[model samples]
Target: MSEKAMTDIRNDPAAATRHDIALSIDKVRGVLEALRFGSITLTVHDARVVQIDVTEKTRLHA
Candidate 1:
């Protein structure tokens, strides 16, 4: 998502709804999985996503 788009969503009052927050979390998880990430931690404050921590595993090639 573009920075402006994200900013728009974050600034939207409807984005704080439980359904919207859940959808956002699911989307983030899907992106991480698609990128083969090891784990992701989402920090939510005031029902908004404040921070995200992603751990990616590096594959070793012989």
Candidate 2:
């Protein structure tokens, strides 16, 4: 998601007012949870979370 999208989600007080919006937010949360062990990058503008990026890593054993 772009910074604007993230910001909109974060800043929107009516997000939970709509079932679809709430579900969408929940889906995003799920994705973040799944990527918990991965590298996460948060871009902040004015001390607010604006963007998130996740990078997963795998280890190979001989």
Candidate 3:
């Protein structure tokens, strides 16, 4: 992320209100596409996602 982008996210109150659902969804989408073998967990409270957890696994071939 660029410094300008970081500043923009911080400066725009609407972009960050309630943990920024749009941004969270975009991030989740990206993670979903990139992950092959992993678990995506969303921690929510009051119908809002508060945290995201990504656990990736490595499989060894015999």
The candidates, ranked best first by lDDT, are 3, 1, 2
**Top candidate, metric lDDT:** 3
Worst 10 residues of 2 by lDDT: 15-24
Q: Candidate 1, residue 21: CA error in Å? A: 1.2
TM-scores of all candidate predictions against the true structure: 0.48, 0.42, 0.61
lDDT of 3 by residue, 1-62 (tens): 78886787799876556347877798899989999997999998866677989999999899
Candidate 2 regions with alpha-carbon error over 4 angstroms: 1-29
| Candidate with more favorable, higher TM-score: 1 or 3 | 3
Among these predicted structures, which one has the highest TM-score?
3
Q: Pairs clashing in candidate 2? A: none
Point out the higher-scoring one by lDDT: 1 or 3.
3
lDDT tens digits by residue: candidate 1, 1-62: 67876777788767537557787778797767677737778888977777777788888889
| Residues forming the 10-long window of minimal summed lDDT in candidate 1 | 12-21
- Arranged by TM-score, best first: 3, 1, 2
